[model samples]
Target: MSHPVDIHVGRKLKQARTLRRMSQTDVARHLKLSFQQIQKYEIGSNRIAASRLYDLSRILDVPTAYFFEGLGDAPEVGARDHGLDIVSAVASIKDEQVKSRIVTFIEDVSGRTVAKSA
Candidate 1:
């Protein structure tokens, strides 16, 4: 059975894929996996192994810790709330350049807005 962590990881994967305007076929081909495999990963029908998780993190350009950002604990003081809103907002972006710009914008804002978090 897939763990809650696996489900969260899948959600993150799908979010990143949509943010980059990439299709499951595209990501599957890039990762040398089948679209069905990608689907399974995205839906939490199967658990991703550690090596695959590393590959996913590398391919998605997200940190490995992203999958476990707030697992098994309450929110920390001042910890950034990572809601589904950001994922939906990212998925709504149509242009890749716009997405990149948004990412950069977030990075910039995070650098300033949460300076203490650094």
Candidate 2:
């Protein structure tokens, strides 16, 4: 049986995708899946496989744990915060090339800093 968590994950996925102004077809193409599969996932009609979920997390620019963040929340607790954080961060990254350079720069700096401190 599919866990209720699947629905939560699906909702988060849908929210993130919509906020990014991306289509189900865009995500499906990136994940090498059919748009129908993406649709099923977004609506929680199907459970996402672990591997696919991980891929979705990356494509959505969220932590893998993002889907599980509000699983135990009260109705008052919102899942929109982290999803919005991702959307806002992504939107501010207006240049794809600059984004790539920034990621590479951060990775390199962090790697060297950690290595030197070790």
Candidate 3:
């Protein structure tokens, strides 16, 4: 059985990759590994080494700690949570104007006002 931590990390990896709009093939090419290897990593079928994890953090433009975020509260791997995915995708937007507009739109649709960022 895969360790829960491994599964959590794999799920985070997939989340970050998807939020960045990267395909497994793109990540594999950067790591010089086969796409199947990337799939294995994402599925927790194979454990990633620390060095490779560091490389992945760099490639994915996320802090290494990002892979461990919410590990204590994580759900089972492959669980569907579209709300979190949507938040993550919105958070990953680089353009401030676009992000602000999206946030406004979300607030309007939800009938809630989010505090403006200083």
Q: lDDT (CA) for every model shown?
A: 0.74, 0.72, 0.81
Which 10-residue window in model 3 sums to the lowest lDDT? 109-118
Model 3 Cα lDDT, one tens digit per residue, 19-96: 555778989999999999988888898898999999999888789998888877766798886855786787688997
* Model 2 misplaced regions, further than 4 Å: 76-118
Models 1 onward score TM values of: 0.63, 0.61, 0.66
How badly does each model clash, as a count of residue pairs? 0, 0, 0
- Model 2 score (lDDT): 0.72
The superposed Cα distance between candidate 1 and the true structure at residue 46, in angstroms, equals 0.7
The candidate that achieves the highest lDDT relative to the unseen native structure? 3
Q: Which is the leading candidate under TM-score?
A: 3
Q: What is the lDDT of residue 86 in candidate 1?
A: 86
Q: Decide which is better by lDDT, 2 or 3.
A: 3
